[model samples]
Target: MKQDIILKRIEEKLKVLKKARPFPPYLVKKLREQFSLEMNYNSNAIEGNTLTLRETMLVLQQGITIKGKSLKDHLEAKNQAKAIEYLYDIVDSKKDIPISEMLIRNMHSLVVQNIDGVEAGSYRAHDVRITGSKHTPCGAFEVPQKMHELISWHKKNKDNLDIITLATEFKHRFVHIHPFGDGNGRVSRLVLNILLMKQGYPIVVILKNEREKYYRALQKADNGNMEDLVFFIAQAVERSLDLYIRAIESSTKENSLVSLSKIAPQTKYSAEYLGLLVRTGKVAGVKDGRNWKTSLDAIEQYEMNLIRKKK
Candidate 1:
């Protein structure tokens, strides 16, 4: 029932976003660049990559290497950028592109190319356990069949499930399968974005700062409870949509999206309260670098919602 309401909100915001399309080319490029960097840095960081966000920007944008970071770290950043670019090409060029094992392998290959050349894209040959997690992935010999099953399951459910539900469930299933020797989480996120982008959703970044929450949701998902995971992902998808709406709608007298500190003074919510609200998805906003940003309009909507609930 809760998922139904959230999904409705997502679809509604998505409708508003779509009508604003064809968005300006410059806006598309700028937003793409922001999401690409955030996705690359945050996804890699969650998997224990050591590059800081700013360092990642240097590696990705300036072709400059960080002095203390490992060569593998630099490559992971570079490779992820390339992989996401490949993803965008396929997503934009093809309509309803079929998801296949080949596509998954290609994405993994692009992700871990220089870091693990031999098994860059291949399923592991031996069973493995996730470090610091209670779940044990399928046995080594089972990976091939498991992945095939995953693809088949996707085929069966693609049209039946909501896209966000499909994407989050796929994230859990793919990581739980642990098909590749490495880079499963990264690949899962890429696959998630492909599923979303095809459906006209903006690129979703699972923030590295939210790593604990993300893993907790996944843990809940492992036990067959999908609500936490879906809600987490729904928040992320909504954040991306907020960015699109803010960009497209910024030109008018409409409320402008600014950092929480900037907009808090204009509303009843304190900076601290607004931060908590955005972080928890009680209100719609965005994470801009290290700072949280929102608008008076978002708070107004939240207030209206609160009043309606009280009545």
Candidate 2:
């Protein structure tokens, strides 16, 4: 009975999400395809629950594996992966790990394991700055010593503030510190996801395709306008939900048009529930087919939509 009530509540929440946008069927189809491609790529190995360190390394290297690197050099690219996995394990333990002095050194130590001149787990005594891109002005920035206060503020406000907001803010600060000589971007994202996953949210992979938007959002955060960061994260989260939902929905469709009947000891079918599924793009009927299939992203989106109420 309790489970049934919870499921009903989920259904209601999805109904609200579905009604938020009356997306055209063609738009839904396009979004589903995008979701399918990304989710499939992400789930290839590292993004899945049963992630391997090596696999995670390969995935991260995919970001830096540029036009000039040899296959051997690329395959040996394991430092970032090792660092991220080690940090993931540490953070996943749910310990109240110190973030200020410890996190930078710890992350830097891990980042430089295979790189040259980067002392394992040490911060630069001297100042460091990034070269200007077309979007950024060329200027040397002294790494702010203010991170001590920032981390302290985070620890104190971690509970009171929204986890997504806090996580995004933390990432912004890490990048601003430019703590490490290199690998700062990857480390910061890994740290953000670690916080997010610990908070029970899914790991959001900001795809290469969305780099412009991602960078712009980061810029907004850097400039002290956090709303852009929040909006960006929300959109990414929603996109992830869309992908997972479509994948699950696709699986259900493959099994049968009516998968609920496959749920063991099923109760009477709810027409309202079926309608909700259709509205949310969880179920789709082919022109010549009698049955509908549930896309994985659709189902996952529905689940996440329900989870928002808990917040």
lDDT of 2 by residue, 208-272 (tens): 55666767877776677878776676566555555545543553344444443342124233545
Worst 10 residues of 1 by lDDT: 248-257
Candidate 2 Cα errors over 4 Å, as ranges: 1-76, 94-100, 133-144, 246-311
lDDT of each: 0.86, 0.53
For this target, which candidate reaches the highest lDDT against the unseen true structure?
A: 1
Question: Which candidate wins on TM-score?
Answer: 1
For candidate 1, the clash count comes to 0
Model 1, 18-137: lDDT tens digits are 876665343566689988999999999999999999999988889997998899999999999999999899889856678889999999999999784448888998788887689999
Write down the lDDT that model 2 would get: 0.53
